[model samples]
Target: MMKMNDVAKLANVSPATVSRVICHPELVSEETRSKVLEVINQVNYKPHIVARQFRTQKTRNILVVVPDITSAFFSKVLRGIEHVALKNGYQVILGDTENNIEREKDYVDLLLQKQVDGMILLTARQDKVRLEELSTQFPLVLACEYIDGLNVPTVSIDNVSSARKATEHLISLGHTKIAHISGSINVILSRDRLRGFKQAMMSQNLEVESSYIQEGDFKFESGYHQMMKLLALEVPPTAVFAFNDEMALGAIKAAKDSGVNVPNDLAVVGFDNIKMSSINEPSITTIDQPKYEIGKKAMEILLKLINNQELHNKKIVFKDELIVRGSTRKEIDVKETLEMV
Candidate 1:
């Protein structure tokens, strides 16, 4: 509640002296700095975020745009972003765009209008050209998902490689008729995942049936419905790979309803080792994407940009791990943490 002037009055110093002590302690005499600190501690003085923003031209706030705030996968990332921002004296403002382009644009306005100092996008809804333009104007970074040819800072795992790893796990179980439940092809990650599944399938000289690849919206209901469709086929697939954990869980439920035993009759693999994937009836065998680390790295990049510092690298890719659980093969569930710095 105490103002800088009040602190200066108590310390027998000018306001500028107090400012110098706080902003650049190295430039201020140790005696002056000690006096100001003693007064500040006595009064429990705190800097006004708004006033500091006015002086520095920074909001001290970050905007994080997420496609679905309810997603547990993104929740981990959000926590990672908040952990760094709050530690740096900045608060995070979360915006849920619901995967709607128009809604996303509305939140992007906050960054364009300078309501937030910088922005971190956790979803992939922005156009490539628009992202390029925004990067030239604002401090922006992409997390979890990224756009190709944008040259903007990005932090994510290799979707294609992760997907291939997941599929290869299923293939190692000696399942030849492996099916894929894909997320929306509109998103590059989804396409990359599908491509990986195909790549793994071809490596084994297995045929990819067009009917086995069902399009999903990265939702549980969509996964369940798609699994049902795959099951109804005259010759159903022996195994399935889902792009996300939610979809993978859905597929498991659908298979159970169809009187199929998981890992025994139909092996299922999922991406994004969300919390639920481990506790589910059949623990999911998934690719750990290091969601939390990715979030933290994205915010770190945004901070560098907001400070007008040069980036050592434009793209940051994290490695993913394949976790073996009950969903794919019946054994002692072995969990692997996706550790990336």
Candidate 2:
């Protein structure tokens, strides 16, 4: 109900002085600031955010493009992004691409339309040239997944290294016949993880069997079905490493359904230490990617770009930890599980 002019009129000060007190408090004297604050509180005056945005050519909002919003993995990262955005006096616009390139393009159009100030893509499948062109003109930050050879600022862990370590953990537990449940090979993240799994196997003089590897789509159903296929093998793998938590959880279910106990008959390890991984029946062993910190760092990078601040660095990679859980433990004897099966 109360505009800046109304407050200015009541306070007997010019609108510009009121603006100074509200927008640039340091420009106004302490006495003036105190008086304007008193009147603002008394009249319950609220500045028009839309008008401010229009004048400044800034929406004070950022877009976050997620490949799949339903996954808890992204949700935690989003929380971190939101935290940083709010602290910096900005709002977040979430765009769930549903793993569809077309949907991601639609969201990108919002940035081009000036509907938002900037964007952070969690996973991208857009044309390389187009993305490169857009990055040159806009404030875009890629998180978790990145395009190789592109200088786009990114925040993520070393997927390949983490995956290798996960497989090495299984090997350390005396699992000779290790299987891999891979995410789609199209994405760099998946490919890097697969490469890491292979590297670990080679380092230990273990044979990376083609029959033991199953392709998944980074989803529970795919993981479940793949694990089922592995179970039917004449000589099933003694351990399995899944690209993500959902797939790993599915593998656990599939193993149980086939009368096999996890970490006993079949050790299971996964990437992304999602919350469910810790609470699952036989809790999953996984690589703990700093989900929240990744989001926070991505947002911080985007803000720096938005404000035209000099970036201290372009590429930021976080470290990951391999957490040992029930799923990969040796407490349950393999012989006992085999006899039960």
Best by TM-score: 2
Regions of candidate 2 where Cα sits further than 4 Å from its true position: 5-46, 332-341
Question: lDDT by residue for model 2 over 1-341, one digit each (tens)?
Answer: 78899999888899999876765454578787788888998988878878877666777789999999988799889999999986565789999988988999999999999899999999967888888899898999999999887778889899989999999999988889999999988888989999999999999999999999899999999999999999999999999999999999999999999999888789999889999999998999999999999999999999889888899898999999999999988674689889989
Local distance difference test values of all predictions, in order: 0.89, 0.90
Off by over 4 Å in 1: 5-50, 331-341
The per-candidate count of clashes, in order, stands at 0, 0
Residue pairs whose backbone atoms clash in candidate 1: none
User: What TM-score, to 2 decimals, does candidate 1 have?
Assistant: 0.87
Could you estimate the TM-score for every candidate? Answer: 0.87, 0.88
Q: Where is model 1 poorest over a 10-residue stretch in terms of lDDT?
A: 332-341
Report how far off residue 6 is in candidate 2 (Å): 6.2
Which candidate's lDDT is highest?
2
